[model samples]
Target: MKNKFQAILLSYFLLLFSGSACDTPEPGPPDAGLYHNYAELTQELARLQAQFPELAKVVSLGKTVESRDIWAIKISDNVTANEDESEILFVGGHHAREWIAVDVPLLLARNLLENYASDARTKNYIDNGEIWIIPLLNPDGHQYSVTTNRLWRKNRRNNGDGTFGVDLNRNYGYQWGGPGSSGSTFSETYRGTAPFSELETQLIRDFAIEHQVAAMISYHNYSQLVLFPWGFTNAPAPDQTLLSQLATTMADSIFAVHRVRYTPEQSSDLYLASGDATDWLYGETRVPAFTIELRPRSSSPGFILPDRDIQPTFQENLPAALFLIQWSQQGGTMTLRLK
Candidate 1:
């Protein structure tokens, strides 16, 4: 009888444990909405990793000026294969007001991985090379745009003397404080107290060195222009022929979709900019780099690019970005070849 009582007690304990376990719920799919915050973005990253363990992994390059995680997605067929092949780095949201910047990178990430198995073009690129995407580089600024001011343009780094934030694009080591770099901390074009002084800039610099990038695209807003290196001067970069060919191909492809004229030229020729990412990437590593300013010109409120424009801008820019990937992987010419 005592043995039977002990057996009943064990069965009751098992039932209680099973009931508690059943009460726990599973997580739902990641929300891909445009207004998703930083936490949601991180959750999306986790979901992508779980879904495509073979193709995606998160890399915490460093912390932002505001101590936010600066995350990057390294997508390829295999980690070993990535090291052997050339890398193409695509970044967006360098400027906070450019809300459209986030969609492109995130959508690109989604499209590339989602279509990796079926899309021959995506398959070929991943099979042969690495694609590094740093979407929303300025999390502090990006979040601020979503919550506070829609026109915020720099990392929220204390610049001292009562000034706050720094133009990360103009805080790189290349030609810092040179022409086009404003001295005033309050200015949008402020180069920062020193080169790479902002943690956000340092994250980019470190990532570039580690990846040995062959080509890069820094997406921006307002101006529908394809800008190359030499942001600090009018002189052309050494790989002018190759860079120009790529830019023309991209511009043509972009125009075919939207029919918008995007004049391709050196940055200095377009507008003066110093200590910028494209120049540093091109001038230092001789990698072909372009600053692609997207749709909704300056007349429009910068950060309020509508959701309706998202699909069209993404569809139009897809071909151009894919062209860059194709060029980087093949290393010969800029041509879109999709089987």
Candidate 2:
């Protein structure tokens, strides 16, 4: 009897422990394994260049706060030469936690390079246009988000007040410090002490000014939105009509792929976020700028999108990206007046 009771007790304890373990929540999303870290992204870019050396060149625009290279891949027929082709820029990972943003542009670059020889449209874009893709802009913040805190959203800048970061998106020079941004260092949308404060923002600004970037897309996430400039206010941009039409077309392209509708609207319609990159790119350079918020139209999956969704997300966004690239070739007709 005693032996049987001991055996029963052991089995009960084991069952209780197993049940408790199963009930415990996961420390992070199980799908976090699906995304690449900064090092992996660097390696992938290197591999792509090696595979398509004639058409792709990887260049480091500058380093991030953590000394990670802010790499940009230029894809064109004459990748090494500065040809007089309309340049289209695609930027991703503006906020560290937006992992899908990084993947979409990276995949877009890979797709274009891989399809150049076989696809006529892909070949045409590469032959006639310059496509610049910066897939990981905030590498430090991204690394931190991937390894330490999944929710981290800013660059790892020490604010000297024990606070750690500045929202890179809100660090641009145009209409900076306006509504929808915070001056407090602890705020998520904290604009830095001044415009173009972060090295990341400064490098991008300098690069855009140096290149004749005709059209630009900066990808963010969780909203499924295709946003245009004038994020600073509700007032219409000088090129509002043209911008709206283009935005609608891109949104339509995105919808056609997965039947997932992404709202086309002004950035201010979403919120009055000043110092954003798209606003600065349009306000200062007269470039046709857009902010594409990708995937998980709802907050359920939020930033931690699953591995299965990665390819599909890239697939849907690819058409929209190609449309923008093709649009750049058309001169991106801007109205060119002050906001």
Candidate with the greatest TM-score versus the true structure: 2
Among all windows of 10 consecutive residues in model 2, the one with the lowest summed lDDT is 23-32
For model 1, the stretches where C-alpha displacement exceeds 4 angstroms are 1-36, 79-82, 333-339
Residues 1-339 of candidate 1 have per-residue lDDT tens digits of 999999999999998787558643332343225645567777787788789999998878787767788888888998434468878899988998787787788778888999999988899898788898988899888777666666789888877688778898999998888998888998999888889888887888878777778789999886777888888988877777778778889999988987877778778886789999988877667778899888775666555677788888788888899999988888752332211
Q: Residues 259-291, candidate 2: write the lDDT tens digits.
A: 999999999998889999999999987778999
Against the true structure, candidate 2 has what lDDT?
0.90
> In candidate 2, which residue pairs clash?
none
Model 1 scores a C-alpha lDDT of 0.81
lDDT of 1 at 61: 77
Question: Deviation in angstroms for 201 in model 1?
Answer: 1.4
Off by over 4 Å in 2: 1-32, 335-339
